[model samples]
Target chain A: MQDDANNPEKKVISDEEIKKIAQLSMLNLNQDELEMLKTDFGNTLKLFETLEKKDVDSVEVSYESSKISQPRRNDEVLHDNKTQKQQNADTSPYFNKKTGYFDVPPVIETE
Target chain B: MLHKLSLKQLHDGLKNKDFTSKELTGHYLDRIAKHDVNLNSFISVTSEHALAQAQEADKIIQRGEQTGMLTGIPIAQKDIFCTKGIKTTCCSKILAEFTPPYDATVIKKYQENNSIMIGKTNMDEFAMGGSNENSYFGLCANPWDLTRVPGGSSGGSASAVAARLCPGATGTDTGGSIRQPASFCGISGIKPTYGRISRYGMIAFASSLDQAGPMAPSAEDLAIMLQAMAGKDSQDMTSANIEVPNYLSYINESLKGKKVGLPKEFFQDGLDDKIRSKIEDAIEVLKQQGVEFVEISLPNSVLAVPTYYIIGPCEASSNLARYDGVRYGYRTNNPKNLESLYKDSRAEGFGDEVKRRILIGTYALSSGYYDAYYQKAQKIRKVIKEDFDKAFEKVDLILGPTTPSFAYKIGAMTKDPVKMYLGDIFTIPANLAGLPGMSIPVGFSNNMPIGMQLIGKAFAEPEMLNMAHIYQQNTDWHTQIPEKYTT
Candidate 1:
């Protein structure tokens, strides 16, 4: 396990890479924000690079509760359309709703 | 005077007719109205709802119905926990106008126990930052010194409790959100073992690490609150199916014959000299009480901060993907297309810290870098957990300082994200290992309170609470309130 903290080879995140990441994250960042993020991502990734130095070849990935297994529930509909409609009404103020459905841009274009 | 009373005292007072629940609730509401201006602890003060609940509690008490200690007690949620019809924002603009249709499991538990819902406290946006400065509302100042940040992301909860604005409040700890703020505010908070409390309605920051617990003036109050909040829930599959212990029963347990380990790694350089000495002095007090202390090692401790930051952000990236402008939450108006809508809404909604973490997370989990970053970090997380397990085999509990230093001035570490991440070095291991941990005020450094952390094995909260309660019995640090906030 080699410590990357002092390793001369640091992973430099480029502006193009940050742009790709923002696109994947569905976040719209302007030029100034992207510039700032490039520097921050580089610094943070350098810190994370040290993880490669640790001897974790045999360690298992930790996920979910250590002792508790995911409980299985009966496959049944708990809430009806009426209940869902009420919830939609509660959230209507935040989204554009028309005819009891959230109005969104067309997903497909006709040829 | 009512605000100063412990949960048990308040419950007894209610039962004895010394003060009605409405009166107690009003007293706290009045205090929040008057004092919360100086400390932006609350995001929404539910005055009307609180009064109505208090009135209902009075009727129950008047009828001599069997009730728990928390009944009729006024308390605040951390704003992360959803309450029916109350705006449950994670102190983030994305959910600023969003209201929950139902209560979180913990909130439901509190309601069932007949507790008054005082309000929702401010927090780090999406529980991301180390200081409350990341909140969309405003920075929640330390009650001790307004310029200093109340350590976050549970800063609002810690500040409200410290200022006596509420007798107790609910706080969620992912990384050191609960304990660090508890330490900074000179109060007590417990981050129960993962799955000890259900997280069905609590907004997810990091699903595997987030656990909601109580912040209050004393360990006894935390025990009472924990007793109510801890249990299995059908709604949360991750919640453990174990029986909830009566934490109150174990508060008086003697510390005699208990082996408390002092982790050597936690005492290394970077800890403030004054806080180190203060912890040492407190250890002396515990020593005099027949509790044995031994030097122990968590060899992989140094990697905790890096491991947590990677895993936390990665999970956050995935969890927060649901906040697209369509179903609920803040939606961008007049979008040309769905893609633009998502980009614009998130760009306009999330704060800088949230965006930073999301980017870091998105990058880590991206196609080429997933193996290098997220997977490797998860492996290191296992190593960190093993370190705790190995140490716990020889000791009943591990004790250390909660934070590396006293609370830093607001905006001091904001420029350096890594520096802010390091603030949680000592506290991250407990969350990493899914172990129960607590912070208790031990002494002061430069007029600011320092906290001594106690880390116990999984589900060993009763023993940990007993130790903290016994320690409090010998010290008055937890009893001391900031002079400025003391009415």
Candidate 2:
């Protein structure tokens, strides 16, 4: 197990680490929850104790259902390509005149 | 009339013109209306569309254009599958008003085979709970005894098939979802190897473990439905591209040379005496057919529940993040900001069980804890899989009681989620290993059905089905339904 210094004196989790985990989890924890997690983060680290014991070299990991691994799909575009703006602009749920974005109901409430 | 017929019998009747597809479909619809009000097995009954499809099937049959093996058979689909224009709520309030614009790959295959979709069945919200009580619509009562639970999260599918509401149903299993319910409800259900069926458009609970398979009255019926449901689809990149085996063709094969392994750990303490006796009886029957039983050890199975709790919920927490009340579904009434929107919408949309699992999962997969929980669970999961792999080298399949005990009365385990989760103890290892497993009726425990699970090596469902079929042929347990409930 790689033991890195966990900046114990720090009051809150570093923004970089928080951002990285948030992106992986797709969660938007508020400031309060994030603060709470700083103290609780050590508890989460307990899983490492279990993983560290495993002998990965002898694990013989097999993800394939069959012995033969088939080739992946060809990397050819079946249709005409669209501009980047054309792909990004449409945010409308019904229909978007801008950049082809599908705009659904707003996720947040306005004050 | 439809209620008494199995899928194979129904198909034969349709093919021989003994009964038209339209009449059979109507009969099933009428049965659903009469039974589902009390059983609470279905969330929505697509009677109009089902009848129309039956008419189309009749036309196809008349023209001698058979679409596939299961032409004109009525089957209920668990609500996790997104059926175009129908409410595809995973039995959660979050997706109460949500309707998908497309169909799950399994549903599409059923349509291609000319199967009549009876209705969408109820389930635990987001497939989170062991009991069907977690459903937003209400608990689906067991067909055998109204007060007891039909095990979940495919409880509705199992109950419907047991009560004969639909000849069969499609259910997704992440961790013991299909087999457990089949065990409780006294029917046959199979969870095929992970990636055997396409996950596209099926609201996923866990990416690595989630698999869709069939629940029905008999292993033969399950085999027939699995033929249509299994195989690769381009939409789901993870789908297995292996050749689809002819499942039905192997259903009646003899198991004389087969070796069935019984894991010693599974038969230890906590198993009910009645269930144990029933399993022993099943073994004797198998032995009479020249099938041998070998005792093996799965040292890691003791840790299966903990490993599953971490992995299933961790993946679930991630999978369910898609329901942010944004793209499509029920949104919070009023939210001051994005944070409140996400929190409140989820709080309101999800049931208590769903929230509890989400919290546990989030905690496990979080940064500081990832190694302790998720990584640890993954490593242990590997151990469980290795245990199975080593055992399979000496046996054609493994057999054990599907659950340590029979189904409990409603509200029995509702207060204790952990205890309720343990109901899946005997079954979850298969999902962890991505192997095909099934539950077939052996006998009764306290007059309720006792199911013996037959787990095969990955993609060995055909062999498992043959073994289960041999046992059923020698015993009358599969033929015995809850006598009083039929009235």
Candidate 3:
């Protein structure tokens, strides 16, 4: 790829993009983080500008592991140890005893 | 007497009855106790277990029993591996008190061979971050200079080896966790082809990219560890069925006509001049030894860090999801309900970088955005892999600097995650390609060490070892440890 200056189609990282990244990254950043990310993100995107000229089309992709699959293990019983109380206990601090399920604030905001 | 012997030297000494296994294990345990308080390379040192194993090894050797290549050697395992009765936190608060009930495949293999497990080393939480600074236990200092970082998530393993805390240690590489840290700390480490070592019980980072390998004092020693560590296992489906070659013997053979490629892209920009010069000088020495070098190109090489960000975090987010306040780990002190429990547990359990990557990964893999980012990056990942494959067809191995620069001061890139992520820039491509690669100390920039990486074809680890072994024979960088580390 050519440098960002040379690639006309490449968009300059903007505040909007930063917001999108923040949302994805689940970051609770202040204005300082957004501003700092502006430079950091730009540098990262700019480094990628080196990819524009190289033809990666002809290269063959590798499966990090070999393609051949292994046979499944026999259905043999292994050590199984757990009590009913252990399974049914209000195991999670997050678990609500009344509802018997996880509780979270609603993600959607009301108008 | 305690610090100078390499794994090979110590192994030979034990075999010859020059020293008992108890004596050797005691020596290492004593050194770790002495210097490790300042260096902080270990999370838990297994003194009691180590001595017991060492005594057993001595008995077996005296009984004329046969043992594997790693017999009687002391090795520190990265905290990511599950060690029964030992803390295996992956350096996160979530599993701080959790001891695994079973051993990881690699740990089991070591145990079977009677290799002494000296301790568990520290790492970046969930194997995130470039420097050991992300570790919740605290930052691990470079053995060479106390103020600087020993490049991380495998920082403890690298630091431990550099400081002679143990003969060698095992480290898992997701991106450049093993190689970059090994480079910065001036040690030898290899991230073998994925599946060369089983990942059955390793704390998952990026499952596709995660690999367990050895960090040692020399390429030849690394070979011995690799021989014991590499093989297929019924427990891990991803383990390869390829024949495990005798790596130590293979690396010592002639490399008269081997073709080496110097990728032009790795040397381009943002690289330290001193590191570049040292790598060039090393290449010159290799050329004199009759190893040929040719200029080559890996297009889309710059996309390494970006692709890694998407894939590694995406995998990490998924892998770490199991740590939800339920199964055998940290739970919030007080929570009104389950939602708060999950949120508070994670927020308190994970470090800043781990949280950041989890959020990033969760976002990328979430609905409505998977196509634009995750899928696109996977396609780009394929392109990157292909690029390496094509280059390997024409060259026996690819050589470059492990990181673009040397280890930076602690907190140098704390505010800049992107900059920290770039430390593994040159190293990540091999992970994406599923190829074997290694970092050997090339030379020092200022006082900190710089590393040169040797990348080989998929499953061509024997070739990579040969290249690193050949270079070490011609240079003294691998032999030079920090002055302060020696007693």
Residues A1-111 of candidate 2: C-alpha lDDT, one tens digit per residue: 112213223333465665455444445456665555543343223322334555545554443333435458788874344652343233213345654454444665456
Q: Which stretches of candidate 3 lie over 4 Å from their true place?
A: A1-111
Tens-place lDDT per residue, model 2, B75-104, is: 899999989878898999988877776688
- After best superposition, candidate 2 residue B27: deviation in angstroms? 0.4
> What's model 3's lDDT at B353?
77
The residue-by-residue lDDT of candidate 1 on B1-487, one tens digit each, is 8888899999999999899999999999999999999899999999999999999999999999998898899989999998888999899999998888778999999999999999999999999988898999989999999999999999999999999999999999999899999999999999999999999999999999999999999999999999989999988878998889889899898888899899889999888999999999999998998999999999888888888888999999999999888878888877778898899999989999999999999988888888888888888888888888888889999999999989889889887777788789999999988989899999997889999999999999999999999999999898888987678
- The sequence of per-residue lDDT tens digits that candidate 3 reaches over residues B1-487 is 7568877787778888898888888999999988999889999999999999998999988886775666787899999999876888899888887777668999999998789999999998888878899888988989988888898889999999998888899998989999999998999999999889999889888899999999998998899899999999877888988889988778876778889998889999788899999999998888887889999999777787777887787888888877667555887776545556666677677777776677667766778867656766776788877778789889998999999887888888787676677678799999887889899988887779888899988788888888788888888888887888777
User: How do the residues A1-111 of candidate 1 rate in per-residue lDDT, one tens digit apiece?
Assistant: 123332324548777898999999999999999887777777777777667788777777767438656667789876586876777565556444446666667777545
TM per candidate comes to 0.96, 0.88, 0.88
- What value does DockQ give for candidate 3? 0.18
Clashes of 3: 8
Ranking by TM-score: 1, 3, 2
The candidate, 2 or 3, that scores higher on DockQ is 3
The global C-alpha lDDT for each of the candidates, from Candidate 1 onward, is 0.90, 0.80, 0.81
